[model samples]
Target chain A: MCELLGMSANVPTDICFSFTGLMQRGGNTGPHRDGWGITFYEGKGFRNFKDPNPSCDSKIAELVQNYPIKSCAVISHIRQANRGAVNLENTHPFTRELWGRYWTFAHNGQLCDYQDLVTGRHRPVGQTDSELSFCWLLKQMEDKYPQPPQDMASVFKFIAQCCDKLREKGVFNMLLSDGEYVMTYCTNHLYWITRRAPFGKASLIDEDVEINFQEETTPNDVVSVIATQPLTDNEEWHRMKPGEFGLFHCGELADGNADQLIDVPFAEKKVKCQAPTEPLE
Target chain B: MCELLGMSANVPTDICFSFTGLMQRGGNTGPHRDGWGITFYEGKGFRNFKDPNPSCDSKIAELVQNYPIKSCAVISHIRQANRGAVNLENTHPFTRELWGRYWTFAHNGQLCDYQDLVTGRHRPVGQTDSELSFCWLLKQMEDKYPQPPQDMASVFKFIAQCCDKLREKGVFNMLLSDGEYVMTYCTNHLYWITRRAPFGKASLIDEDVEINFQEETTPNDVVSVIATQPLTDNEEWHRMKPGEFGLFHCGELADGNADQLIDVPFAEKKVKCQAPTEPLE
Candidate 1:
């Protein structure tokens, strides 16, 4: 399976610390060595850096880790190719423009029988099942709302429904963002941690690096990071159950109807569906 | 005004040498210090690196210069920010998906009264005259052909007509590519040079660097470089006239109708129209 890493923040912040831990898993600590990509959303604008090479040996990935590009939303992926060839086109963290906003998506799990999913104006440039799924989701959203909806909760609800359908195909843990809001849907493995005031020290699980969150933030700053696996061992990450969905805005779980939105339960936790595409298996 | 650079090659060629010279003009050698961006196409897939920071001092730009990412088509820009703010959103080389291909564009001149150019499905995420023109162009193309046209020459003709209309508003030197063909339109300043066998040494105008093409390229390789100005001082560059459009494919001016497609002049060469937004004036 590929790994996904995302961040949503109240203010523009950099993901250098968390990314440093995840880069090790791209090759050194784990087996997702096909390719890796990351997208940084600076308000309505964003930039993506992708390398067909393994992250552990990528100069572009190293530049990204060193450059503290402050952004409110970020999506990153390290891929282990299954359905697509190991090429630059098959790299993860694909983005397409919708409703005058660039929507970015990265998928962690594989999907089976996804070729039947019809897409509209948004089409996949790459051959990955992940990209096909993202295009299909965007088509569904665009079909529902010709423009951005007046009520965004309906948007989140619709996304949950679409993801629930996709989960039925196979593992479909995904992280999607449209510059302002980050929506996460979990089918198998996903975890998130929100750090605010009264933050303490944290140590990376994959690397021998420690960081003090207190020194890196203001008292009012709130930042949430979602990943396939917990990057920091000391932090209390909320392990998402299968079929759980989350909508994060300004670094916190969005307040209104979040309780209802968080627990959809389309599939039971640890349910083994019929799919040989699962990379972990 | 801004500086535009593009490359089209028969083989997957790296633009490190030319980009190194262009990076110097971002802040050190010229005045386009607002921001910079570049897109490299690998088949139908592309990766974009943009920075609101000046390219001369940008670490990302440094990484790009050092990393020889090979691509057959590349579009890059350095902006001085006349019509928009100096932010990441307004950076040049804006991209949108059309006909399932990522269409990359970079404009070097300003447009006057461009808000009336209505766009359809494709919309501009960034607030810039350049992006507005790109979106408008895509909308026009989409309206003309729901699918990719069987006769690409007709598509080029339509693009030339649209560019002629855009040039009527103001200076609109642009470089656009759909990962296959590099289309160039000039109103003020644009130049191109193609190199193949019997290549010699070339010296950069902006940087103290020289490269021997004999060592870097094979005999079968045909590479073309297009820029707002001639990057290499020693090479003879073809200066495109006002209202001229050229379509390049596989590093050569596409034959069969290239002579008929090369020149479609609608404006005078030295005619200075009314664009109060001109930065170089």
Candidate 2:
């Protein structure tokens, strides 16, 4: 299993605060030390930084930590090798171009028999189950809708259905974005927190750092962060139940099913159905 | 017009030396001050760093110049905007994945009436003639060959034909790579130099930096550098002709027609055929 972190904000915002806490978990506080990657979406353009080295010690990671790149949407991951080798190719936060928009994805769980999923135009550059699943999901979308739907509700619902199917194989916690909206699907462990006006100070759980949101953000700003575990101890984080899917657009929940959290009772059964490829460390 | 830089090596080599010179041209010594980008290929995986800010003052560019990210192939560009606004979306050195391999491209010239070119599956995210041409070229390849060609000679010929067609619109000097080979098509100003064993000292034309290659390189290292203009004053760089197309694999010329140097008469005719959208600055 791996760790995932994501952010969406009404205004351009940096992830240095939450990223600092998450970087500690990459190798210092947690066991996800195989590799790490992050993608930042700025309008229709985006850039990604990845390292095969552990985030705690990677020089590139250090540069990212110091540099404040503001973006509306961001997705990051720290990996623990399971199905693929620990190399640059298998680093998380995979990206592909679809419908003239760049789509980015990162997965946290291993899927059994994922190769059965047929891929269309999009193919995986890395030999990882996460990348294969991403390619299949995009291909499915490309085949279903030749053009982007006028209403995004149908797209969100269709993606949720795909997530439910993948959950049947094993854990399928995922974070995906196409520079416009962020879609997160939870299977086991996922939490999110939204900060708006009247924000207060928050202290990180893994790092000895405190940030006052009110001082850094404008009153109209709305920012939301999603991660495998709550980065801060003071803030009230919402934990998603199994088989729950949510979509965020400009830091606000956009999907109609946002409140209707589905509690699909397939977590334990799916774990037993598929033989573990490698024992969870 | 823009400035292009590329590198191909038999072993994983860092382009910091050549990149330092190019960085100076991005804003300090040249007029290409709109944006800059670079891509580094590490085996089957690659990562890119791009900034809308001028490279001379860009913190990211400074970091890139200081950090030595070794790669077998690299493509970089400094933009002087002509058809598109100076923004991150229009930054050059765009990348897309095809046949499970990453393809990167950077153009050094403008196209006239290029919007008429019909793009198939691949589409340009930014409204730039350079990106539009790249997408069209890739889409053409994707349409002509579903899978990677077994024999690469035909593919090279097909790409050269595509370059000729693009040159019909206007200047189309470009640098492209698909992780395996670095292809350069010169429609105007493009120069290349290969350095092997018995290396000597080279001094940058833009910066006052000098590097003694003999002290840093091993005997088996074979590295080639390509740029819009000669980067080093002392090096014997080969200036490509208008319709000349060359392919480098593992730092050596792979295409048999590399020495043929076809000087197609389309250069003078094409300039008069298409009405220039923006005057040459």
Kindly report, for each predicted structure in the order presented, the TM-score of its chain A compared with the true chain A: 0.90, 0.90
The most accurate candidate by lDDT is 1
Question: How many steric clashes between backbone atoms does each model show?
Answer: 0, 0
How much does candidate 1 score in TM-score? 0.91
Question: Each model's interface RMSD (Å)?
Answer: 11.6, 12.5
On residues B50-114, what C-alpha lDDT tens digit does candidate 2 reach at each position? 98778888888887898888877899999999989877778989998888888999998889989
Q: For candidate 2, lDDT tens digit of each residue in A75-101?
A: 999999899887778998999888888
Flag regions of model 2 displaced more than 4 Å.
A256-281, B256-281
Per-model TM-score, in order, reads 0.91, 0.91
